[model samples]
Target: MDTHDLRLLANRIRRRDLQAVYEAGAGHIGGEMSVTDLLTALYFHTMKVDPAAPLDPNRDRLILSKGHTALALYVVLSEKGFLPKEEIATFLQHNSRLNGHPNRVKVPGVETNTGPLGHGLPVGVGMAKAAKLDGADWRTFVITGDGEMQEGSNWEAIMAAAHFGLDNLTLIIDHNRLQQGARLEDTNNLAPLPPKLAAFGWTVLEIDGHDMDQITAALSADNIASGKPTCIVAHTNKGHGISFMSDNVAWHHKVPNEAQYKQAMQELENAQ
Candidate 1:
């Protein structure tokens, strides 16, 4: 899809995500909203995957490292035909397969079970390295929150990825600048992320995360460095697209009340 269509789709995804969070009475809605555009660009325009064959050996893998926003990933997976759309209503409900965190074993499109802050990148590195060893053309992509970067494990994975020359691996940081309870700057800031990644021997690209064109361009395989892992510092707002909630840390997991939900839905509709 082109950038315009991708934007519309992202808005729809945001609407659905809002409804799901309100219905479930709990979710990382702020982060979900912030990452929707990146997710939409990947599943729709960037990744090479077949919903009919979710486990295709050569399919590009996406690991949502910041799995607290699994609702957004689930919505994208459903839109991509990995699961039935009706299943979205089961989110966080009793005995639902769609839990708060993604489970690769149960969710067709999910590559790894991720929830604990910093595990996805390491797993992605392994996947990319395996593909390299097998001479496979598939790639591995991981998205982590800015706060999640504080985890030392992600830095270790970065070092390993550079050492192994896993150019096929891409790490996209959702640099929204807010965590669950506070701004990232107030809690262990990791600003100037581009320089840090560049110093680690990775090709880093910084862009407005919500811009569909920029997102698609950054994710294109043609931009991959020959022998260096790629890192995309996607600058974003915490509660993107929704008025009143944008960049507000309190919305991290706050359930929208009836009035708030309606307003959020209307804002999304107006954007459409």
Candidate 2:
């Protein structure tokens, strides 16, 4: 898709996410807003998957490790026909499969259940390893929060992936700089993250997470280094596309008031 078309589609998905969060009365809206563009670029522009056959073994895999951002993934999945778009209205409602965190078994396109931070990369490594063993060409992509990197398991997986030469794996960090209570720098800095990943023996790319063209370019398979895994540090805002919440730490899981909701909707609609 062209940049203009992808931008329009992203706006539509953002609006859907905004409405779902507003109606659900609770969600990880901050992270959802930050990562929407990355998810849009993947489902709409990068990954090769049939929404009609979400479990097709040969299809590329996506694991949302920061699963609190499942609302973003849900909207993207719906837009890509993996689920009924209307089902999005039920997000976080009682008994809804669309819960606060993605459940791989219940959700069509989700490859793993991950709300506990730092789990996605390891699972992605495993997925890539499986493909290697099976001689399959499918690739695995994962997105996690910068704050989530504080979890030690990610480092373990990094070592394993590098050791195994899992070049089919890609890890994108939503480096928004803010976490739930504080900025990543103040809490536990993972800054200079690209160099850290490189030292761990992975190929590193940095980009504006919300830019479709940049995201697409960085995600391209040709960019993967031979004999190494790929890691893309996607710098982003905690609450992107909405005025009051952008870069605001309090909005990490803050429910928007009615006025804020109306204003956010207007901002998103105006993008088109």
Candidate 3:
């Protein structure tokens, strides 16, 4: 799909995500909205995966490191045909496989069970290293929130990725600048992330996270360094696509009221 189509898909995903969060009465909606574009570009345009062969050995791997936004991932998976769209209504329900965090065993497209911050990159590094050792062509991609970047484990994984020359690995940081209860700057500022990742010996690309063209270009493997991992610092708003919620920290896990829900849906529809 082209960038225009991708944007439309992303808007649709955002609408569905809003509905899911409102229906479930709980979700990391802010982060989900922030990261929806990245997820859409990956599943719809960048990644090489067959929904019918979910376990295909050569398929590209995507680990949603900031897994609280699993609702967004689930919506993308459903749109990509990994699961039935109707199953989305069961989100956060008792006995539903579509839990708050993604589980690899229960979800077809989920590569690893991720919820605890800072685990996905290490696992992605391992996956990339394995592919390298086996001379495989498949790649591994991991998306983590800016708040999650404070985890020392992610830096360790970053260092290790460089040391191992795992160019097949790509890490996209959703730099929404907000966490659960406060702005990332107010909690633990990790600004100017590009220099830090570049100092660690990775190729860094910074771009407006919501721009589908920029997102698709950044994700392309054409100009990647041969022996260095790539990090795309995707600068994004916390609650993207909605008028009142954009960049609002309070929306992190807040359930939208009926009026708020209607407004959010209208905004997304207008964007479409």
Candidate 4:
């Protein structure tokens, strides 16, 4: 898809995510909106994924480490034809496969079950390593929330990926600078994130996470460094698109009321 179509798809995913969160009465909305564009770019413009044959060994793998935002992934996957759009209404409902966090066992496109802060990269490293061992060309992409970087496990995975020379691995940090209840700077600041990743013997790229062109360029084949893992520090805003919710910490997991939901829907519906 072109950049223009990608934006439209992203807003559609955002609208679906917003309605699901409002209907479910619980979600990490801020992070969901922040990461929607990244996910859209990956599945639509970057990854070699097939909904018809999701288990193909040669397919590109994506692990959403910041799994609290699974609603966004669900919407994107639904739009990509991995699941029926009607099933999205079942999000968070009792016995629904579309739970708060993605379940690989239940969800077709999900690579693994992820919700804990720092597991995805390690899993991604392992997948990349396996592909390398088999001389497979498939790549692994992992997305983590910035706050989740505080987990020590991620640092260990960072070391492992570099040590293994898994250039097939790509870690995209959704650096919105905000977490569940506070800003990352107020907690454990991982600012100057690029230098840190580069120092660890990984190739680092920085880009505006919400920009489709930048995202596609950074993830392009020519940009993947030879013999080194790549990490992208994607600068983004919490609650990215909605006016009142953008960068607001309270929207981290706050469900919108009736009026808030309507306004939010209108804004998403009219997003350029």
Question: What are the per-model C-alpha RMSD values against the true structure?
Answer: 0.6, 0.8, 0.6, 0.7
lDDT of candidate 1 at residue 103, scale 0 to 100: 94
lDDT of 4 at 171: 97
Model 1 agreement with the true structure over 154-252: per-residue lDDT tens digits: 999999999999999999999999997888989999998999999999999999999988999999888898999999999999889898899999999
Where is model 3 poorest over a 10-residue stretch in terms of lDDT?
Answer: 177-186
Question: In candidate 3, residue 176 scores what lDDT?
Answer: 93
Q: Across residues 114-226, which tens digit of lDDT does each residue of candidate 2 receive?
A: 98888889889999999999999999999999999999999999999999999999999999999989999999898989999999999999999988889999999999888
lDDT of 4 by residue, 140-245 (tens): 9999999999999999999999999999999999999998889899999999899999999999999999999999999997888799999999999999889989
Alpha-carbon lDDT, every model: 0.95, 0.92, 0.96, 0.94
| TM-score of each candidate structure, all chains considered together | 0.99, 0.98, 0.99, 0.99
| Candidate 1 residue spans exceeding 4 A from truth | none
Give the Å shift of residue 157 in candidate 2.
0.6
Off by over 4 Å in 3: none
Model 1 quality (TM-score): 0.99
Residue 121 CA displacement from its true place in model 2, Å: 1.0
Better of 1 and 2 by TM-score: 1
Residues 1-272, model 3: lDDT tens digits: 99999999999999999999999999999999999999999999999999999999999999999999999999999999999999999999999999999999999999999999999999999999999999999989999999999999999999999999999999999999999888888899999899999999999999999999999999999948999999999999988999899999999989999999999999899888
The TM-score between candidate 3 and the true structure equals 0.99
What residue pairs clash in candidate 3, if any at all? none
